[model samples]
Target: MSLCATVPDWQSPDLEVFSFFLKFCWILRMPMPTLQTGLPPGPKGSLIGGNLAQVGARRVDFFLEVARTYGPIASFRIGRWRLFLVSDPELIQQVLVTDARSYIKHFGARTFKPVLGNGLVTSEGDFWLAQRRLLQPAFLKAKVVSYAPIMAELTEAMLAKWPEGQSVDVAFEFSALTSAIALKTLFGLDDHGDRVQIDQSLRLTFELLTRRLDALFQLPLWLPTPANIRLNRAIANVNAVIDSFIAQKKAEPPGNDLLSTMIAAQHEDGGRMSARQLRDEAMTLYLAGHETTALTLTWSWYLLSQNPDAEAKLCEEWKRVLGGRAARAEDLGSLPYTSAVINEAMRLYPPVYVIGREAAADLELGGYRVKKGYTVLMSQWVNHRDPKYFPEPERFLPERWLGGLAGRLPKFAYYPFGGGQRLCIGVHFALMEAAIVLATVGQKFRFTVDPGAIIDIMPQITLPPKYGMPTTLMRR
Candidate 1:
């Protein structure tokens, strides 16, 4: 009954040829359900890499083509792994909302763990739920509203520093501004020296992270490569700053800042997050809180410069609403066009362009049988530009969002902030901060892109202007 007895003897010459054939079959075999039935159709790919070569470089374009060519539910392969790109809004909702429990954060999220640690963005199951519950109160509408003053004030200071007609890199300027705002609002680090150190470390960390994420073949972190060395140093620098902040907070009474609020938070079982947890959470907030907002503002400026009509409308709204004064939290509602411009800009170039997950079990999505362990990709870049939902999809039209058009769209049709229980906790904060900054800056100046600069989209951790957004500021 032994299995070896059922096979040819290893010493036999015939066994050698049989072994080679078996190896060949294994190598060439597609990692999907039997090709005879079930699994959805996809582009044929090479044996070794599958569709990696075809879909790796220009992922957004590739996904859009897949959706356009194969309809909403398109299947592909990356090496031996089966991948699915779901473009249909209803199917996307199932993956992100209705059947969300059936999937977990995919491999893409793991790449963030080296920087974010086991914080809110990376943790799963009970730990993630616990962290979310504990941090919920800090981002409540009332608490977020209190940070509006800080956002508006920081933006006003930033505007004052710019020379009247100077051509500056708006992307870099916004990054610095948002980093300062995040530090103040999240950790209450208003000291000049502390803010400088933290901001520099954050910039380095993000640069390294973006490179690693976008690389076709990322080297292991343990290697002593120059990028890895730099990443280690950047992580250490950020950790040093965070540890200092936590130690300083521990020695003092609780303050109104987000860090202090988190430190003082306790679970029903009376458990508090340890020092390590606190550091992870702080780093997560710092990275997630600032970068997206900055990229949004950066792209907003570029879009406005390209579309002068939209820019004019935004300026008119600011002048009519704020009357050349700094924008306050209350002014957010009055400046509808400014908000619309930001909305449209995000629709055109969402900072977090894609949301990825992995199937935990066999399932059916959009009438296709998706086997277990497949990677599920839902891209905002593709879905946001769907012709069915957004007519004249390529045009930058802000007015389309003016009259509850956004609310009327299918639920997942326009999720710049994502969806489901894991929706970005800083959604309200980001929207408020963007509106305030746009209104405050728009009232004073208009930015025009440099004619000679070629701005390219570097879609890494965020969609940033590859060459930086070089623009001259004109006093309005």
Candidate 2:
């Protein structure tokens, strides 16, 4: 089937009628139509660019405001595209699970294709399914648990350098630690391979991606604008790093690391991913696997710093279970409070705050008729803070999760890792890593964020501290 065939034909006479209707409304200053017209109520955006300028830099806050001011299903526009933000849990379920195949990754997600390529995060249809199948084994609970020792080892290595009284930027420290762990566990690189280069390139690339997402107009990447040239160079640097990892892995015998697993994995028909396929999947996993977990840990530390009672409770749990030893897979089950702390951190500051999908065909959603090519956005930042499901939603209450609360809540209400088949593949890996690192570090060191640190969210692809989390290291 042709891609163009699936897109709505705006050239049809219906657009002329819509234009006439808008002119009529402008002349009389009448209110826009509502659900009776098959469109949900939304904020009134500017005529030329719709809500593009209103969204501006604080998009996460804007999404929350929109969901709160309007109902669960609200309509808005960004340039020529019609967008809907779905905040209702049941409605979210319908889009992500019941009718999953009717939607594809939206333009916001597609912005990373220059770096992520057609890996699971950006790919669609049968190819994404096949790639997911081949990669599933590497992230299963059994396989993921086996990587705990490596996580603990890398974390301990990082902690070794942190003297008790020294100050550290917790964000940068966690990012470097996780990047090293990712290089080892994902690509079979025993050392930090291209860590500095990879970090610089990723920063530049993601900065451009965020800019492109907010821009009312954008040039194709093929054009040689200054931003495009920088983006290309940044991408080339990352590709070089991935290529080097692949070359190094090829020379050595296969190991238990994920890249090796992907290399050896075969489909039911004995098909395998080509070198390019491997690069795409590796890039996706490398970015997805590390940064989100890093933010999880970084934010966990920041939250624990502010709430001493929660920090003390977490530390006490670690003291009881770990007893001055490094955390292992066996120790995780006994550390319920540790898990709670991580969960609460993600609730307040979800790394991947929003999930978006564009309708691949006309469909009914939340009692409204959504046309093909319309975009639907569901934000964890909004749903996780619903007062009905979570009383005092803004408070950092790890105890809220202590007594089967997770099981009691609506499925989509607290999905920091998202929901349904498209849920992050690294859910288990990320949870386990955050728990182990939190336990191992909390047992030895605690961070005290400055009282006036100017900590705020950057609202990039992942929610990171705007000023970076600077804290004094206090030994336990």
Candidate 3:
């Protein structure tokens, strides 16, 4: 059986623990010696596979273990691939900002290119820079805030359907709301006719892509395999849905929506994006735009459900600030506690929890030599829980963020949206959307998470609730 199949699923830890222990036994045979290699400390792995097997299906936990056991700068191997986990804030700054030009996204990110194409997330070099410049104007604070009415309108629509005193999957609920918002904001579509097909196809494609990334040896896409066949079909379905939207958008006069902005955006030389470029950027925006905010709201509600005091405080703030009206863009500044709750929740369950880059040239990080091709991983999962910066790191204390803690924290210390030249372009839009959605929903209703629901982390490309957050809708 495959090592992946050995672990029943994320829900059951017994087999996963046993599987990890079995692989971990290989490390016991090796000794920890510096050997003048100048490499940082990490767990030894089997001679053939390195730490790959040991990291099976528990990468988030494994990364936490590596950081804790090996210190700020840690090294390990997976097959011939070398990876470094940088936990120190200063070193993280150097990698992400100061010397960012010396690196590109890591191999794992490239694995999604088949689906994501040469979009901003996967693109590199001059082309990526040009595209970023074009998209920057649309996501600026002024432009993002203009969409607040649409966000509030859609959120209220969702709240209307949320049955009070009924059990619902909060994950699915937030996902649907964010999907509607993304559809309206991205493509100027309110019908959401293609959403089900698009969501199903994207989910399948992501699952298969993850499996391919985790496999010891990646098979070529051309070669026919059951997984590959399904992946191809899923990709085809997603592209079909996207193409239909692009077609629809092209048929209409330009609007203020993101797709229209991309279509109409011109370069200094009077050049607009090509059809392929538009599709790629649209695909990137369509996926990246909504998933993070949805997860943010999903995890926020989950955290609030667990911490009633925080939830109560949030409700109190909304009551006082908005006077029972839905949140508007102008209300953002007045809603500091609302922002803190969202910030704190993101700090704990960051949507894009881990990010990595590959060294394009040999360089020094934290006084250690990093060879070209070495992948450097920065995980919000590990860093956010660091005891030094966030005292009582495990606690859900929104109050911690109340007193200018964000201003006081290190630049990289609380980076849920990431850092540096490649910081998420949707930062302003996402923050505004989450704040609007949170305030709009909190005043009228609260959630009590199902007592028996098994909550865990999926830890795929994004950090999602493993089994879905089932909760009872409590009308306030």
Candidate 4:
């Protein structure tokens, strides 16, 4: 038993949290490394480190285009903010894996900023390490298995509701489906008022975070513009809901859900999370747990819909193995084809397509001179499509993953979950959930994209379908 044990199961009273936060405020720290100057060749920027030009619409995509022109190692500036774009796999491996402690996360991850409030996703110092260690036990293999029944239940429920022979947007469905699964698995709640409020707040706050990429850190958050207003409202709603949930949880007996585990977590140092830390961690789980998996599933459905042959192969596998019964998470190991299919889909349309890192200190990389104060980016969208690794990269070929192709690909060449010490903490959990959900949904219905449906890439925080992936679901 630790501080987490002594703290109330639900929200801590306001004053306790307020007092801790007030004492903690005004303490700023940046554990930055020194920059090695005269780095790689890249585009030039105006005063303020190219800040003016970089703060426009299409920020992520536009930066990707620059990576294309400037080659593997490119540097640019946005109002004195040195942005480094690296495409070479070796250099990326070095930055993320070989010398991991040298770099920190890039300047983007702000959506989690307000909600998670320096939880695992944002913490960089000892706090992050400590929290990560305490939380690791809950996501282990055995613990992940506990989540499967919830995954199966939710997927089947949605499947039951899907009207056959009518086209529905798979992307929208995934958004809802994954969010539902996240809520159920993490908080042990189904569709309820409090649960719905939490989900609604997440969408409102994070949706704004993705759309308002151009206005980060520039203006006050309380501004009345559509983006600011919606964002603030969403944050308030989310914070309030979390606060109440914490209070309620504290007054009750403990359970086995993620929220409970976090509440019960304690450190060897005899420290425990404050109520605010709990809220932020919960928010982090909510945000990171759902979005990317939804995008990957949507694209997988879209791709299979386009390739009838692939769909037929998948059907053949399902018919043979499932024999008209629903598949379970444990069945994933037996469903080799499904995993291959997912791998191929991720290659073509990776979730969180690009990774961003900041230069702690300037150092030479990939034969290019670099400077400090630069943002370094590695694009999964680029490397996954590279001809050297994936021949005919545009083609949707699941066989490649089944054969020796995946094994032959360079270590860093296929990093959908990112790499280094900052690799996604939920990688194993996400993989299992996605596989189970895919098998269940794919085996039950034959879905295809609605003809003439626009497939614009809304490359927001995640590369999702802009127009939404419309598909007709038919019973097998």
Using all chains and alpha carbons, the TM-scores for the candidates as numbered come to 0.89, 0.91, 0.91, 0.85
Task: Kindly report which residue stretches of model 3 are placed more than 4 angstroms away from their true locations once superposed.
Answer: 1-35, 268-271
lDDT of 1: 0.84
Higher-scoring candidate on TM-score, 1 or 3: 3
Badly placed stretches (over 4 Å) of model 4 are 1-37, 44-64, 110-112, 193-200, 223-226, 244-248
The ten-residue window of minimal lDDT in model 3 covers: 26-35
At residue 440, give the lDDT of candidate 1: 83
Segments in model 2 whose C-alpha atoms lie over 4 Å from true places: 1-37, 266-271
Candidate 4 Cα RMSD (Å): 15.2
Candidate 3: tens digits of C-alpha lDDT, residues 1-476? 77887655666788678667766766796444343988899999989779987676688889989999999999999877899999999999999999999999998899998889999999999999999988888788888888899999999999999899999988988888888888887679784768878977887788889888878899999888999999999999999999988899889988888888888888888998888889899999988889899999999998888888888788888888998899999999999999999999998999998999999999999999999999999999999999999999989999998899988989998898889989999999899999999999988888888888999988778988889899999888
Better of 2 and 4 by TM-score: 2
lDDT minimum window of 10 residues, candidate 2: 31-40
- Candidate-wise lDDT, in order: 0.84, 0.89, 0.89, 0.76
Per-residue alpha-carbon lDDT of candidate 1 for residues 1-476, written as tens digits (9 for 90 to 100): 99988977788888787667777878898343343765566778888777877765777788788888888888888766788888889999999999888888877777777878999988888889999987887788888999999998989888889998889999988888888888788887763566567767766777788667655578999999999999999888889987887888778777888888888888788888887899999988987788899889999988888899888888888778788888888888888898898899899999898898888888889887777788899989998899888899999999998989888999999999999999999998899888888888887888988889998886666677778899998997
lDDT of 2: 0.89
lDDT of 4 at 76: 68
Shift in Å, residue 194, candidate 3: 0.9
Q: What is the lDDT of residue 22 in candidate 1?
A: 72
